[model samples]
Target: MNTIDEQLWDYIDGNLDAAQASIIKEKIDTDAEVKNQYEELLRFNLTFDKIELEEPSMSFTRNVMESVAIVPAPVAMKTQVDKKIIYSIGGFFIISLLALFGYVLYNSNLTMPGFDQKINFNFNLDKYITPTTVYSFLFADLVIGLIFLDRFLRDKIVQSKKI
Candidate 1:
C-alpha cells in the first residue's frame, strides 16, 4: 500500500496522534485522490464491522478430543522387551553351545606322542571340511555380526532418544 493509504488507514482506525490525524484529515479534505481512497477504506471498514464471523458447531471440539483420545500412546522398544525373556534365551543358547563343545572335546583323540618319537601331524580334513561347509560357516558369521551390529545401533538410537 502507498503512504497515503497507510496514513488514511491509521486515520480511520484512530491510531495516529492528534498532529498526524490532523495532517491526514487536511490531505483527505484537500486532495481528491486522498478523499476517494479514504471513502473506499471507510466503506471497507464498515463492511468488515457488519460481517458476522462463522463459528464451529458445539460438538466440534468434543469430537476432535474424542478422536485424539482413541489413539494408543507410543511404546518404547526397551520397555516392550522383557528382561527375563532375553536372559532365558541367552542362557539357553550358551548352555547348548557349551554342551556341543563338550561333546566334541570328549569324542576327539588327544593322546600325545612321546617327545623322543617323531609326531605325525598329517590329518585328512577333507571329510569334515568341504567348500560348502566353509562358505556356510562364513555366512553364519556374517549374519551373526550383522545381528550384533543391528542391536548395537538400536541401543545407541534408544540412548540418544533419552537424551
Candidate 2:
C-alpha cells in the first residue's frame, strides 16, 4: 500500500471504515508529509464548496425550446442500407463512369488538348482522364436519373389512384 494521504483525506470527510480510519489516524500523527498533504487537499475542497453557483435565467428553458422550434430539426440519417437503393445508385454510377471513360478515350485518341507529343507527359495516363470531367458526368447522370425515377413513381401512383 502507498501513502495514507487519500485514505486520511477520505477519513476526514467521513468516507472511510473505522479500521481504515484508525490506520490513517496513526499515520497522520507520525507522518508530517501525509498530514500536510491531507490538510492542503481538504482546504482546496472546502474552498470549492464555499463558492456559489448562479441559477440560469427563469425563462431560459422556454426561450431555448422556442428558438429550437424556429430552427428546423436535423434530418435523421438512414442507418441501414436498402439493397435496391444501393444497387440503383451503384448501377447509375458505374454506367456514368463508363460513359465518361469512353468519351475520354475517344477524345484523347482523336483531339485532346495538351496531348501533343511535344507537350504531353510520356507516362501519366491521368493526362487523358480528368477528374473534373468524370465527376461532372457522374453528378449530372445521378441527378437526372433520380429526377426521372421520381417522376415515373409519381406518374405510377397517379395511374393507380385513377384505376
Model 2, stretches more than 4 Å misplaced?
A: 1-5, 78-163
lDDT of 1 by residue, 41-108 (tens): 99999999999999999999999999999998887666468889999999999999999999999999
| Model 2 weakest lDDT span, ten residues long | 1-10
Write down the lDDT that model 1 would get: 0.94
Q: Write the per-residue lDDT of candidate 2 for residues 1-163, one digit (tens) a residue.
A: 3546567667878998888888887887888998897788789888989999999999999999999999987988979978999999999999999999999888875656875566554776787679988999999999999999999999999999979
Clashing pairs in 2: none
The global Cα lDDT (0 to 1) of model 2 is 0.85
Query: Which 10-residue window in model 1 sums to the lowest lDDT?
Result: 73-82
